[model samples]
Target: MLTLLVIFIFVLALTYFVTRWAGSMQKNKMAGSNIQILETMRVTNSKYIQIIKIGSKCFAVAVCKDTMTFLCEVNEDELAYSSDSRVINTEGFKTILEKFKKDKPDN
Candidate 1:
């Protein structure tokens, strides 16, 4: 029983390290590419609308399971771009909790 548990842990750690290494390699490969996907919105399970930048031009395209169609060229000036991955929450948890309590009806 102890040997089985040890083998399980070893396999789990190996899998985690392998996944992290593969992801880093893939990210490095995609760095400094001319074509980049700016944003993607899913329309259905297999369909998506994407904004992509190639060279200095940006375009909107529709992507399906096996086909991609060009929708139109996009103006970069009109787009709202953010480099930050984290969302800024202006309200604190205590303030939100107090507001919720105030809004609750007394029975």
Candidate 2:
């Protein structure tokens, strides 16, 4: 009876560890290279405005339940970023969007 209980506990621990490892792997795979979400604001319950940086360039986009709309492209020079391990920008996304609109010529 003791041997059976020990075997069952070992199996349970192994299963738990394997499941944890697989979940961590899935999270790592979901975030790929060079795509960073700088900021996001909730416009509604299911809608948001997001700023994303792809490589050296950045963009502002509107995200809804069924659609994603490109709002504008942001210039890197307009951003004020802190030099740190986790490099986050000090300037607000709204400020950048306004600057971008002013600099962009109307067609």
Candidate 3:
């Protein structure tokens, strides 16, 4: 029983170290690449709240210059889920935005 427990603990610690090391390597590799923030805002206006990168690949995600949100990369490589990957027949984003436009609340 004691032997099994020690082996389990060692395996857990090795897994933790490997995960952390792999994450750091990916970040540094991508950093060296020309992953630039293109001039586009998907959700917010005038703030560049959304960014685009055109390098070895392109991705769009919620990143801004204000630094309110930390730098986290959401790789748009594959489908997030099986359901979300299916085709959609709804109107385009512009139409939806215009339809939901609201006036500023009188503060």
Candidate 4:
């Protein structure tokens, strides 16, 4: 009976470890896929850095006319972020980006 209990405990521990490892692997794979998506983008005259995700959104910090803006990509929509940026949905984010893209260039 003691031998059976020890074997059962070993199997339980193995199952727990496997479950944790699978979860971690899924997270890593998701991160990598998102990274690939973030890599494909175009930034204009601004001195832009590449993307780095903080949480849900992919972000690029850039400077235009000595001001900082965070360019965020969220679900195919883009957001131009300043200090006062509000959390936005995909459509709102795209609208903000369209407006930003239409700005007249500073001389």
Candidate 5:
């Protein structure tokens, strides 16, 4: 029983290390890729709309389980982004919570 438990723990650790190594290798392989997913919105369980940047152009695409359809090309100037060029919520949770509390109706 003790031997079996030791084997299970060893297998788990080995599996974790292997998974991490593979992920790092894949990340390195894609480090120089020009294609990047700028954003994605889910419309259904299996359907999504994604904004992808390829080279210097951005495109909107509709993705389904097995198919991808090009929607349109997006103008970069029309999109809002932070100074770092990534779309992010600048508001802190505490700020949003305080605003919500102030807006709540009194009992």
Candidate 6:
């Protein structure tokens, strides 16, 4: 019983460290990529609206469970924004969350 407990604990700690290491590696990999998802909003259970930044351009896309439709390329000047306009700020996420929360049923 004691041996089994030791083995279980060892396995758990090994898994924890390995997972943390892999996550850091993945984050580093993504940081060097040219394409990034700036923001995403769920339109329905399986549908979403996403703003993605690829290199110097930004795109808006409608995403469904089985398909992704291109909406348009967003302009930086639309919101009096700078070149980094493609990236959604924390306030934008907060607003989107509030809108969804208000629309969600209490049940």
- Per-model TM-score, in order, reads 0.70, 0.55, 0.37, 0.33, 0.71, 0.68
Cα lDDT tens digits, model 3, 1-107, are 99999999999999999999998899788767676654444556534454445565545455555544534444656424356434454686788676667543545
lDDT values for all models: 0.91, 0.87, 0.62, 0.64, 0.93, 0.85
Stretches off by above 4 angstroms in model 6 are 79-107
Q: Model 2, stretches more than 4 Å misplaced? A: 1-15, 30-32, 80-107
Candidate 4: misplaced stretches above 4 Å?
35-107
Alpha-carbon deviation at 47 in model 4, angstroms: 44
Better of 4 and 5 by TM-score: 5
Off by over 4 Å in 3: 37-107
Model 1 vs. true fold: TM? 0.70
Clashing pairs in 3: none
- Deviating ranges (above 4 Å) for candidate 5: 82-107
Question: Best candidate per TM-score, number?
Answer: 5
lDDT, ranked from best to worst: 5, 1, 2, 6, 4, 3
**Steric overlap count per candidate:** 0, 0, 0, 0, 0, 0
- lDDT preference between candidates 5 and 6, better one: 5
How do the residues 1-107 of candidate 2 rate in per-residue lDDT, one tens digit apiece?
99999999999999999999998899789657798887788999999998888998999999999999999998867866556635646797899899999999999
Q: Write down the lDDT that model 6 would get.
A: 0.85
Q: Taking the tens digit of each residue's C-alpha lDDT, what string does model 4 give over 1-107?
A: 99999999999999999999998899778865544323423457655455565556666656555776776555435645555444334465688888888895767
- What is candidate 1's lDDT per residue for 52-72, written digit by digit as tens? 989999999999999999999
Candidate order by TM-score, decreasing, is 5, 1, 6, 2, 3, 4
lDDT of 4 at 34: 40
| Top-lDDT structure, candidate number | 5
